[model samples]
Target: MWRDEAATWQVAQRSTAEIWHLLANVDVVHGLYYLLMHVLFTCFGPGTTTLRLPSVLATAVAAACVAVIGRRVAGSWAGLAAGLAFGLLPAVQFHLQEGRSYALVAAGAAISTLFLTTVLQRPARTRHWAAYSTTVLLTGLLHWLSLMILAAHLATLLWTRAGRAVLARWAAAAGCAVAGVLPLIVFSRGQSVQVAWIPPLTWHMLIGPAVLLAIGGTCALPDRPRAGRLSAATVGLPLLAVPQLGLIALSLLQPVFLDRYVLYSMLGLALLIGAAVGAAVRAARPRFPTASRWILPVTLAVAMSALLPQSLATRSPASRVDDVLAIASDIRHLKRPGNAVLFVPPLRRDVKSLTPDAFAGLRDIALAVPPEKSGTLRGVETAPDRIRAALLAEQRVLLVTDASPGARPARGARDRMKTAVLHRYFVPVADEQTRGRRVIVYERRSTPR
Candidate 1:
């Protein structure tokens, strides 16, 4: 959670030119989002709440857009229900508190889809088409993968038998979005190593999509003869199915099936569920009118109750695999002044950057240059010889590693050297383990073995 968010904050803290340079090299996919956060940090100053506020606001906007979409496709009751469902979604709630671009990307997806609907409904409206294209372009800029939603939209348009002119316009807008994002896509491809941590598709990876399909299928059972020209099934089903199935299929060739990547698809599920509930309530009103009034409330209450534990848990630090703030706090409490610190594997430099205040008292022995000076996230580490020399020079060393108990030893020469020197020259004094993080302290022995 904060691990990725902290990286984004660090990027935003750099100068505009530096951020642009970093984006071109490493995170070009989120270039627009970094620029937006950079402007926000400049105006508001930086803090945890300040960093996450934009995402919260974006989530609210996404909920509103979901409501609008529901209203256009279903009715007022469905719109309200959909909005509430969107807000209550666990994934949506989790991202709302994060400092990353996912929430904004979700919002952009919803807004762009809303515009796409308008374009389809009024095929002759040039302004609507322009707005749709512009929104698509902007959403693609925010997150290149978000353009995957266009495939779902394409399927929707084709299934609905949209006019040839409408289909052509939709294709043109999608093409414009792809053209606009091509540079980012190309640059990001070079940085593909960034997401190498994503594992190949597994049965576990299908759980989320399966659960969503189950819920959507259950909701789809109820008949809504008057659902509207763009029925909930037409829009919601594809939005839920295409991106997920497409990602899963692509993951067979290359690993890239992360649920957060398609978090916006939940809006489609919510819309369909909302439409079903509203339709059922309306259909029941003619019979047992008194009980029909309670149907919507009862359904909503049950859904929220089922999600309550997860929603509450999501707000806690423990919900995340690694909490950088907690890790930094523990390190601060355990560390002594002037102690040398080594981040095993070297990529964990963002942990220190995230909690600068907590790590300010410790010295990073391997760092030859600061991140700002070197224009790199982890900064430039000293040579292996210098690192070993610096470790030998220290009386006390703090080793922060991402390794677990059964994990393989460090592969890099510098990492291996650090471990070898520590184990060979020093004795372990303290050890602590948190999710995905390990901190150990070693003291110089009176006589080296």
Candidate 2:
């Protein structure tokens, strides 16, 4: 497991009351997902399969929704193409097995879009609007960033030039959904510091969206869809463009432009690609009717072939930034009884929390409280002077830190103090670095007073 997955594993292992308390102080946005995982772990016992099964199922549902929407707007061939394409997208594949809520959010977005497509084709019944509103509300609860889909849907309505009844009903349904999630939005604002690590937007960030829009726009061109039509261009284009552009605009004020936040947008891209395939099939039927049937399968086969390597890579441990399990194994092998342990940035304590057995018989010299009791992901730590004093007393210490040699220097007094004391008083006895983490054994200098 990587750091984020390790976080889910450890947090979900906490008791219900402990999770509730943790949410009160941090990670409120993931409260529902963590609770859901907690239940799964309770029933099935915590393991990789239990941790990631929901995401796999959710991704399947999202792909199915894409296929259904594509069939409604384009044709059966389009539906098959879109569904297959959705699963093949690099972004979709990356989160397909993640233990995060984003995949569920993507599934919810696709369901909401499917409902909207149905309502647009038929008269907007009260039940349809209710289902739409409920889906939106649930998706927003999963992750408020998904509420960006609401803007994309509004653009769809405008592009289609829906009657006042449709527009008014959409407004009412969207209003209910927004109102339901508004409290979560209000509460999660207090934890905004969780996103402080996101870097400021730059010109290069635009390249990905621009490339996606170009491809979606190209696929849309073949449709010749009118403004007031319920076609791929009218629905798919806005779904793909609005959320990405909206995120860029929002990043002007805050740096929240992670593409996974808008992973649902890939559904739109898939729909457009399917429509383009449908158009090609129609045009080719007149000339080579028998061979035209082979078009979609042939296209899918080529795509699968092209993406096979990347897909395999995503399934590997190297895909993530670091592997917490590997780091824990090293700690387990290198540690001795009563050895003092220190995590340079402290957040590296996740390794211990996720696999405590690996850290058995070791003392966390800097921790003042455990994570569950402290209601923090990383437990509270002692002051710099106390940590320095503790380090001075220990003959041997184990340091688990990031592997990057050029990582940012310690900024806080506590972290700086740890670094200074280690350099001045300790000598490296043994060191092993793997999987983006380093485990080092250090001993006090021989001539030290």
Candidate 3:
């Protein structure tokens, strides 16, 4: 998790103007988050705690908002149960420590939905609608994909048949949000290459939404006629279904179905589960008053026990696809002053950017310009001929590459040359592999003849 956190930290390390320039061309979706982290880094200095604190706090606020939604739609017991269930969610816990926009996006979704509920319930307050629109706009600024939550809100409004007046207000608010996000959408489109790695919809993607619906349906079954069930289904069902399904559907044309993108949807599941548990407890009270009193406590205890392993695993380095801190430590131990480093694809140079301090003693032999100077994350690389010459000239070269199985098979002319140079002039001296990356040291076998 913190492996990707380095990208956030790298953006934070730049000057505000530099960050703004970088965002104009790429990463516009996370522009607002980087700005917020810039302020945090300025005040607290860039440490793991400072980097991740906002996400933790945002998660706490989102959990509180879920409780409020549960109370409004169901009851006090439902609210408590919903909030507790939210905190125990594996997805929620995973993003809490991440220094990214996902947690903030989830928080924005919760708060904006809370406001949407108020506007629907009252249907007269212009201010409520304004607040809702503003929150939606802000959420989109944090991460444009969060606007998907508005589709769920639209579905909920339509399902409830919340009078023409309420529907009109929601439409107006949603239009304003769309307008607010238009510029970012345009800029992000220019950077569409970022999401190219998203695979097409799979059985797992289909199963995720189906499982959520099953849980919600089970909850709704127990109290079909109750206002609580109706409200929960109206709001929760779409929130759990639409974002994922919409993304999956769109993935056929363009891939974007990532679980973290819709992490907020879990709030809907929690609300339904909480309402069902509360209903079950009430239904059992008359038959077994003593056991009914124990229901909430026992349920929470059991839930926590089930979630304990996942929560603990979330803190381990293995939980992340890569661990920048661990990689940095390895580089520190293995590298000597003036050692030359080569990122196989050149883009892999980002690994050094993540742990700049550890790489201070080393030199990027193929770098033609620094990242800040080039206005790119990985920086510009030297020409292919220059890279080959540089590699041959070095006594020891550190090769960094993706940890994937196919990484050794050269995929492009540049990579082929890199492999050829390494094999023709050098011998492997040492190697280390991590979850996300591989590091190998090659020593000159003989003088370049």
Candidate 4:
């Protein structure tokens, strides 16, 4: 999305500054993120791999950062576990496969939070302060949502340490942050859309992050809590699990809630919980055997890891690069000017249509509605009247219906395109198949004599 949309916007505007001009008012703070991504993609050359390269490298670098920070917080063993766990996380794995900035957001958020914590705990550390400021500013520029993570970091910093130190550092950082981000702050005032939600913390949601954290955090947490079983379970499981639960609930209603965005929050909770459990276990000999403490955490981790889906439902092939290339080639060959492309009933959210996904590849092919916007355009056209109103412009109208043959709207949409109401407007030319998925193509029929 970042690649295709930014590529189109930048091409239309012709310069980085112009790209900023178009988006700054529209996306507000998020415009800066697209602006920066625009600069990099231009330099790297326009393609998904080129566009998303920075995020891949950033994820690798973030894993390394985790290890370094973990060692500082706990010990070498804990650092290794934390780094490895983050790299292998199911959420991280999913985001890494996409050509988006979320992975970089995870990296920047994690590194910045580490700096904020370090500076708060050891107030006199100037180096950590400088580093914290840089990452926080960069993260804000990278994504507006990064601000939320920064808010959580600042809250934790103020709450964790006592009066003068916490107040002083937070004030200084907040001032710097605001001054640097004045541009986005001014722009994001009116255009944004929001979805409200009631938080859901269910059993399935808790299982994964909780188990991973307990396993990874064990190395760092103190030994006394570590000795017994109950201490480990309580600290290790719920601490990390809770935030993931919050995220999962948010995601269902608003699909915008991606897994990687709150990964830093998960790690923070995990470390605290694991340390508590380890400490309690060491305090006394428990009813269960000494091995049971280790045994249970290990068992849960293995089971949970197995359950998380490694391959998400892709709109195309599971291999994102191959899928994009395949679609792009198809667009180059099949799409031509004067060929009217229609997006009827927009593609279903659950079902990924090849048309929108392959739009960027079509070069100059005029479309019914641009691919990036197919969803919104479809949503806006409610009844048959609205769909009919939108259809009058194109000589050829292509209907994008869900694959379910039994759905009422899908049948209606197909029927409408068949020319029951507008007899002279369209004729079916071809039916394109994408990996067993279907996209029907149509052209305008001649007007009656």
Q: lDDT of each model, Cα atoms only?
A: 0.82, 0.91, 0.82, 0.50
Candidate 4 local accuracy as lDDT?
A: 0.50
Error of 3 at 272 (Å): 1.0
In angstroms, how far off is 318's CA in candidate 4? 3.6
Worst 10 residues of 1 by lDDT: 220-229
Best by lDDT: 2
Best by TM-score: 2
lDDT of 3 at 173: 90
Clash-forming residue pairs, model 2: none
TM-score of 1: 0.93
lDDT, candidate 3, equals 0.82
The C-alpha stretches of model 3 lying farther than 4 A from their native spots are 225-230, 404-412, 447-449
lDDT at residue 240 of model 2 (Cα atoms):
97
**Model 3, span 1-449: residue lDDT tens:** 34468788788989998898778767878899999999999999988889899999999998999888878877777788888888888889999888998999999999998997777666468888888999999999998888889899988877777778777888999999989999988889889887886787777678877887788778866546333223766777778777877777778888888888889888888888878877878788899988987888999999989888988998888788766555666677778888898887666677787667878878888889888777677778877798898887888888888777635466567778888899889998888887677888889987542
> What lDDT tens digits, residue by residue, belong to model 2 across residues 1-449?
88888879988999999999999998999888899999999999999999999999999999999999999998888888889999999999999898888899999999999999999999778999999999999999888989989999998998899989999999999999999999999999999998998899999999999999999999999889898888988889998999899899999999988998899999899999999998899889999998999999899999999999999999988898888878777888899999999997888899888888999999999999999899888899999999999999999999988888635677689999988888889999999888878898999997753
Query: Which of 1 and 2 is ahead in lDDT?
Result: 2
Question: Deviation in angstroms for 275 in model 1?
Answer: 1.5
The Cα error of candidate 3 at residue 62, in Å, is: 0.9
Better of 1 and 4 by lDDT: 1
Clashing pairs in 1: none
Write model 1 residue lDDT over 1-449, tens digit each, in one string.
Answer: 45788788898889998887676667788889988888988999988877899999999998998888888877777788888988898888988899988898888888988887776665468777777888878888888878889998988887777878888888887898889888888878898988887898989888988999888877766634232357676777778788778788878988988888888788788878878977877888898899988887898899999999999899887777665555776788789998889988776777887777877778999998887667667788889999999999999998887747534568778899999999899999998877667788999998887
